[model samples]
Target: MTVQLSGRLQAIADLVTCRAVLADVGTDHAHLPVWLCETGKIKSAIAMDVRKGPLLRAETSVRLAGLEDRIQLRLSDGLEQLRAGEADSIVIAGMGGILIRTILQKCPDRAASAKELILGPQSDPDQVRRQAQNLHFRIDREDFIREDGKYYPLIHLIPGEEEAAYAEEELFFGPCLLRDRNPVLKEYLLRRMRTTGQILEGLKKHSTESSRRRAEELGKEKRLLEAALNRYEM
Candidate 1:
């Protein structure tokens, strides 16, 4: 089977470091596991999903790739079905950050046992980062992807001390991304600032107390975005 991932998934797959085994949560089509196994990056992988439909599809993909023995398919909610030390690297992606964080919180032992946890959070990346810290996992690195007009945040976390490796704002944005002045992140901020500008302009047309409060909030956000972009400036 020839599994070609989207650019977003390919980026996540490229960052995967599977020395022994890999467990893919929310493996809709098992594309990542199939691709990794086909490329010799992983000898074995467990493709799991909360729904039976996806798991069935994943099984078909695995079988077609001639990796039915190599890739195991399971119907699991989050990481509940996985046990500690069973997988060297675990990937929980293509889901909301809250659900992702909840999965980690619910299965700390399974999450902590992995050498690496590759997270693809669709929203609330900051909350996920904070949760990872609370679970004794530090953010190893971060990646930002803009695909099909949507923003995706990929956070790679490993079990370790929750060191002060990031400032408050870095946690909100991303430590690695801001430190490197990533062009994608800068563009995301610019887009957000522009939207806030438009909202503020609309708020100006209103004279309600709520509108005033919203304008103030957006003004603060605009200022913060500008300050973050200032670092990227020469």
Candidate 2:
């Protein structure tokens, strides 16, 4: 059976190392693992979700994909149900950045087992990047995609921290994406610069201490984003 993934999931799938055994956290309908297995990108997979409802649905999808033997479905919170070294790659997608950070932080053992981690954090990607560094996993590559009017940043991190790859602003955006000069990211930066400018303008109307401080912060952010965008001009 052929499984077509949405743009966001497809972007995340593209980051998975070829032929890697998979552990898909927040598997939801288990679309990714099933598609990967069907396409021969993976030999086996464990599709996990925190909710029984999703796990059951995943079970049905796996059964229909005729991958019941290759794909196992589990009800797991984060990586809690996964054992160390059980899989070659771990994927946690469609989650808030903070929760993804928490999952990695809470399951160092499980995380250490994988050769790669494919993460797609819905928000606060900077925090996710910082946490990955704290876990000693440097980004192998990264991508930013716009799906349905929202932006999703994908990070592929492998165990070990290396020298600085990009400017510290990557913590605010992404290292590989910045290095690649991804046009989608350029679009996102422009939109954010406009938003920050608008907020700063509103903050200027109020001269309270907090307003002033917020304006200062936004001003800095505006400048940083502009600098990142400037690289695209070169």
C-alpha TM-score for every candidate: 0.93, 0.94
Residue 128 displacement in candidate 1 (angstroms): 0.9
List candidate 1 stretches off by more than 4 Å. Answer: none
TM-score of decoy 2:
0.94
Q: Could you tell me the lDDT of residue 160 within candidate 2?
A: 89
Residue pairs clashing in model 2 are none
Report the lDDT tens digits of candidate 2 across residue range 1-234.
Answer: 657899998888888884868999999889999999998889999999999999988988898889989998888889999999999999998989999999989998899778999989998888888888887888989888998999999999998876965575778788678778999999999999889988987887897999988888888898789878877877
Clashing pairs in 1: none
Tens digits of per-residue lDDT, candidate 1, 1-234, equal 488889999989888876679999999999999999999888799899999999888988988889988898988988989988999999998988889989989999999899999998888787788888887888788899999999898988887986566665676688888888988999999899889999999999999999999999888778878777877873
